[model samples]
Target: LEGADGPGLFNAAQTLRQLVTRESSKGKGSKGDKGSRGFAGVTVRDWPASPVRGITEGFYGDAWSQQERLEQLDFLGRTKQNRYLYASTDDPYRQSSHWRDPYPAAQRAEFRALAERARRNHVTLGWAVSPGQGLCFSSDEDRRALLRKVDAMRALGFGAFQLRFEDVSYSEWHCDEDARTYGSGPKAAARAQAELANAVARHLSARHPGTEPLSVMPTEFYQDGATDYRSALAEKLEQGVQIAWSGVGVVPRTITGGELADARSAFRQHPLVTMDDYPVNDYAQDRIFLGPYRGREPAVASGSAALLSNAMRQPTASRVPLFTAADYAWNPKRYDPEASWEAAIDAVAAGSGTEEAREGAREAVHALAGNDASSLLGGRESAYLRPLLAEFWAAYDAADSDKKSEVKRLRRAADQLLDAFGTMRTARERVPDALEREVRPWLRELARRGEAGEQAVKMLTAQARGDGGAAWDARLALKQLRADGPERGAVVGKGVLADFEKRALETSERWAGVRRKAFGDQTVHGGPTARPDSPAEAAVDGDPDTAYRA
Candidate 1:
């Protein structure tokens, strides 16, 4: 505490709180317990690797409520995050067509209160405006309108502002005035954006006096390599303005040091802040990614000025991944995804302060993680299912006698998973409401899919025993359980049941010939055979060359 400032002191306090909670969970150092009375010899000397480590609510879905934003600020403070970007595409005045309008009385009050809350939490409320959608950039009136909007927010106590030109059409001018003044090309657009940003930065500096550097997100923020527009923007944009880059692609699978270095070179050494688009599951509403933060090289921190995670619409659900992101930004070199994730789970679960609540929260995290489909970072599934899948797969690939035991084990695992889902559905008071709301649908789907998998196992076993009636019943049940694609509420584990049904049918049909022979003279209807020159079968068999030759 001697050398630590506000954030450093806050982080130290959080670490100590976590240490006490952990020890308490282990039944040590409690009121009635016999244990050491002093601190656990743990010392944390922590500081952020990047100057700006935070979350940006710059998504395209439903905006988080003011209460949610306030709660998120508290969570960010607890996790040691120091910045919050209040840019949601759904907000018309903030982005979209109504860029020049001021917030109404009620909304302005909300902003003032939010700014106050942010101050209490030591978080910088970075206000952002997006006028590039239809701004006549060359018009004096248009420039004044943009400045007026920033001025209003500055009055509400926001010391940071971002001019967002991202996702806007900069290939051509918005009006005849811009076209006549700067011509219709990338350089013209870059010049217009640069001038507007420079003006805003200068105005903020002169008026606000100790404001943080201005931030901007250009239209071509994500790139495989630099373009004329990027180069021009880099050269023309004011040196004090920080540029936001989204790695190689808009939603890249990985971000490496090479990509960052290339982007830095493209931007002519201007301050680059990474606008990471992970754990933001808006694009694929069928997924709620509960995976630990991964795919960002440690060198990314040193290569950029700051790192900001783009958050999902569900603020509570986003905590698990954001927690890992906070750790990475604090100390990228020694960041461990698994350790951070486990700690996050513990922190979230222990928030309710009971063993039962902790157990329920852990279960919810597992269920949600099971539904994640991120290819870059792996996700967690129900504890029972993880081992069950392994056992089932191992037995499946083994001899026939081993199959029965594995099948029974798989069925038990499925039953246990269903039971867990049932417990979560009913344990309203034991689990967090947000966690339950976000994870319940997936849990129900998982239960249905588990039933389908159990039926498939039974169908396979019945076919092997020549019991056509039982196999037929199981197959019919499996077909009925097949998912009819993803419904709107079906965000997590979408299409999982359908995939299981398809695989089950394929396995069942593979043994049709033997089943027909077993029940001789019964006129059994075997499924359709592979067509003589069918591409589907050829691809499955890896015989494209042979099929073409034939």
Candidate 2:
């Protein structure tokens, strides 16, 4: 807390978490009143170990622009996130200022409008100004550019600036690379960089009178475990300037152990900003959490959901960090990786009458939104698979011929499979209002269990990361839960409705397995794999249709 730019500040925020009532966390997402608050007399506890627990925007090219950035800022605020890293190639307003283009007449006005909206929502916007990279500023020029940028931000009302020192000399805005580089040694280089950056900080504070914090992106070479550059940078992290680390496992689209280790090392020096880790690779593509741009495409939505889910799973401890889902101008590096599908579902389900009705609607809608096994099983059975049988055969014939139509033939197979799955939407749409009402209770219970189950895992992991005694206690609690699985399992000793809920949650959990099984059934995609001999043989005896149809 002395300088207010270290882990201590982060610790203070964590302590603040315990001070907050449990109602806050649950209010964010917990269904009904049954949450951390319900279980005990509300004891809140949270702390971020890193200074910047964040995500970025404006990296993945021109895919995300002004409007998308605003929306993502709102989303970050809802999650209690505290930072925004704007790394776009082209400025939002398409103009430039020396140090920073005084928000320009157009850009400044845009920022002010965005700031008004952000302020209303309790979001503090941070700027990641990269003068050296895109601005073509030399070391001397950088001094001036920094001043201009700071002045511009000050004029527009911003308190923090992330100084990104990326060296891009090949482009049109290229500057003498060495003149702007952070140099070889961390100290000497840092000393020089700090002098320049500190001047900007001082100038901004003096000029704006409300100077925000500054975070400098560390040199890329610091990836080495024991490098002088890192040590110098750590030592030279000027009084007000923090360090930001690039999440490099991206690009190729991977977050490996080595990358995390490097991050931990750099974090030990000072709080670091994490970039390019959002819109997680749900489909395991190189790009993760890279976009929520140009409106909602289903593929993008699903991909964003996957990335958000993955980002949620990371054990990041940065305190004052931000997350963006915007793929600015289509640059993968600056994609906001925080989009919550679960939250989205909850949003859609809000105000849909009773809780049960809301939940039933959620499932139905989810079914329509996907092509997985769970979607297929939403209503009745696989009667639609029969129609695609001929198309499937044609794909097989195409595949066998020595024709050069491999991609097309494979695409044909995929189309037929999708055609079969499309039946889910038809069935979901046909679901009667009476049936929805009938299934409402089961759906609510299912949603509750699914959510609670995931939270239980998170809670245990959280406890494990805490003090030893608490960790041990959490361990025992998990063991007890496991032992009580028979009773704990949603369907165990339950009625027919309870059984259905259990299957639904399980199917959702094993979505991939369900998908494989659906295609692995008596179909061409089932190719060579042993198909379920009697998958559609209906149920076991006694009015099979009534078992699910009713």
Candidate 3:
């Protein structure tokens, strides 16, 4: 706020649980009193390590609702994110088909409202246009169309702009003028793109004056090192125009400073902006990534001009990872992903109903994030459950190999696993409804797997007690639960939990002398069905598409 590149501020209130403290006098206190219960003044010097740290709505999926965008802006502000870029692939007004058309009145009104909300939150609204599919770069008419579109959007309060050439051709020409002005090849395309980018960026500097610099997503936005196209663009593109890259890969598992240096070398003199693609789930729409942001070196934050993370379709659900990303961007030197992760869960769960309900929501969210933590970032699925499962097996093995130990050890382990399953099964009901709606599919799957897990534990525990009758009944109930659908819907507790159920059921079926599959022919218990033919063998399916009343 002081100069062209002055310090910025982000007051992230969502993570106040991190700052929460219980104070009482130290040493030899009453058993109930932990610390002096009083507020203490503190001086916290908070600042972002990266200049531009935020998220981009650039996923290829259904466009987010206007209200969703408003919530996202608030989230960004509360998470210390200072920028939000609008670049959904599905938005036609910003695409090649309609890059020049003014937004419809209803949409224009929505954009203005979004801008005001962003301004209130101190978020700089940024927009990106993808006009590479049919743009004749050499044509004066096309250039004017783009500028006019930018002018209208600038009037609506967008503070930054980006030209996206990621989806454009490298060797083909769209028009006769483009072919004559720029020859066929990657280098020629890069030269033409540089010509346009420099002009637009220079225009922004001259006309907008104090607005943020323009950025461009090059044709090789995700590649490693220099190339004919990258070199050409690097040599010819304007110095102040930022080059946006998605690390060494489109969504690299980890971005190190060495890679950033490589990227800078490739882009030459232009300032580099890193568009990190995490959490966005268009490629795997059934799941949401709720893991902590990690595998990035500290220099990745310090070196980039701006670091923008990509978001998922579910706006509220994206906040967990986004919150951690902001923490890393704010101070990568002191970042602790696991600690930041726990804080993120508490932050998001803080809004759930009453005190008791908020506590429940926190537990539910923590359990959910643990189970759903695996992503392209590549970590163990069900990280929390893994240790519990391992403990159960170890206790069971100890009890089996030596016959004199307390069965309490085995039961205790099983109970812990069951409690974890119970949390997963009921998390949806406990969390905020807005979050519940976004994750219903995945949560239901988690519940199904949890139920199956409960039955599996019952089966094994009964076998441990030498109750053949009880073991058989538990196995049959598990079979019935499996019939209700264990393999349906979104993925949760993917490899670890499913493997436990499979191995448990297999061991149950292979029991030395227990009877299995004892069901006989069925008969109707009540006269309720309108169609007698479909009565006892049928199910009252909830899905209307598959259910016929008759």
Candidate 4:
């Protein structure tokens, strides 16, 4: 655990934790100090592919709680992510309106404590200040005000700083000084912004020597080719000051090596880093992307000076994808997104002691994550349920000569689908409470989706077995559930599961529309009658994860 810096030990500790599993917390109030590992007589020495592999809390909407920030810093350390940029766009002290002011005493205290936690986790704490909206780039007062803000932030243990111009207007200037000093248009805005960044970089170099190089998020952050703005920034911005680009769009689906090279070439050799905006759902606040990082070439990691993910509002739930992003950032060449995603799911779900079979939290988390495993980056939602639904449909659609045998086959398919829905129904109850809050809506939708599916399956199966009363009731319940199923923002199982239910409903309706007269008032048979205390319907119910009198 030796290095020129003190963080090496923290990293080594993280590595060691990965090598062992805690085995002792099976009992109530147990210390859980006991652990075991398969690896023996081994030493691991490692380094991340990218230098700044961490998060930028740079999303829109609500800022994270103080506890969330602290937890995020710890997560970064655990994953060997060495930097954490504090830049929640909604945080008053972080943006244009309040960039000149200091944090309140309470927030300042929180920042100091965050810094200490970051230090313990081997994370470099950085703060981003967006002053472009109100800054007169040419004004002496604005320049010093920005610097004073930086100094104040530094005093609270921010080791690095980023200047954000991503949200500012290109045609407008904050003061008359900006139009007078730099002239007008995109090129002028670029030139002015570059000079301001240069001032801050030089100031940091002189006063805070050896701290991380200053970074700037350009107004033309994700643009292609060499524009007037790019050219001006290329020529004027200090070389050591990092340029942050968010791929080719605010949240692009793909970022290739060639595209990155092109963007770097456009910027003309300033140190370039990617502030990849995956898993950040600020624009679409209804979702959380739990998929593994994808569509990035290996060189995207090796080529960048650093790679930072913009995190979601939900800190704990954000770990699912952020973990994969960190894994890719550390070693992109060997990354397998699916495998990494599964491991990440395990790592996160394991925290809530969700290790049981069937309705356990692990499967529940998988359902929750798999159903939400999509974002701007592009992934299949309901990945876990898709195959199960397919299997059910395959069996349901199979052509069978024997009626009873076919009913048996269809029932088997329906049962598997129902079991999966069971997991989805109870997903929220299984995870940690904090994580539950962030994902409660999704979990609720998942449960609703599952319940709707179960009703559809039951309705179809009941009709198949010539049970008139049961089939009618199940269909009625299913219709009502479907009516209630239109969630405002949160979606689970996406379209496919709904399609399956829709098809089932249509097939049942179709059968009803073309039914024979049942050969002169014959009685229809159904499943076993229910006892009063435990209704037969309890078996198909969403919760308790158990069948009635099975």
The candidate with the higher TM-score, 1 or 3, is 3
lDDT of each: 0.73, 0.41, 0.81, 0.79
**Structural RMSD, model 2:** 19.5
Clashes, model 1 = 1
lDDT of 1 by residue, 1-550 (tens): 5336776776677767667766666775357776543445866666678777889998788899998899999988888888998898788887658888888899899989888988887888988888887788888998888888888998887878888888677565678888888886788889889998999888888878878899889988898677899999999987868999989888887899998888888888888989999788777775677778888898887667778999988788788889989999888999998789777776666566555667776765655554553433444433334554445445444425447765565555445544544543434344577666655655555556556666776776566555767877877777676644433465544444355457657666554431222356442332256454542344343322222222
Measure candidate 4: CA RMSD: 7.7
RMSD of each: 7.5, 19.5, 8.5, 7.7
Ten-residue stretch with the least lDDT total in model 2 = 312-321
Best by lDDT: 3
lDDT of 2 by residue, 147-173 (tens): 765666655656566665644232233
Worst 10-residue lDDT window for candidate 4 reads 541-550
lDDT of 2 at 365: 38
**TM-score for candidate 4, residues paired by index:** 0.88
Steric overlap count per candidate: 1, 44, 5, 0
Error of 1 at 400 (Å): 7.8
Off by over 4 Å in 4: 1-5, 22-45, 353-359, 399-408, 514-550
Give the residue spans of candidate 3 off by over 4 A: 1-38, 400-405, 486-489, 513-550
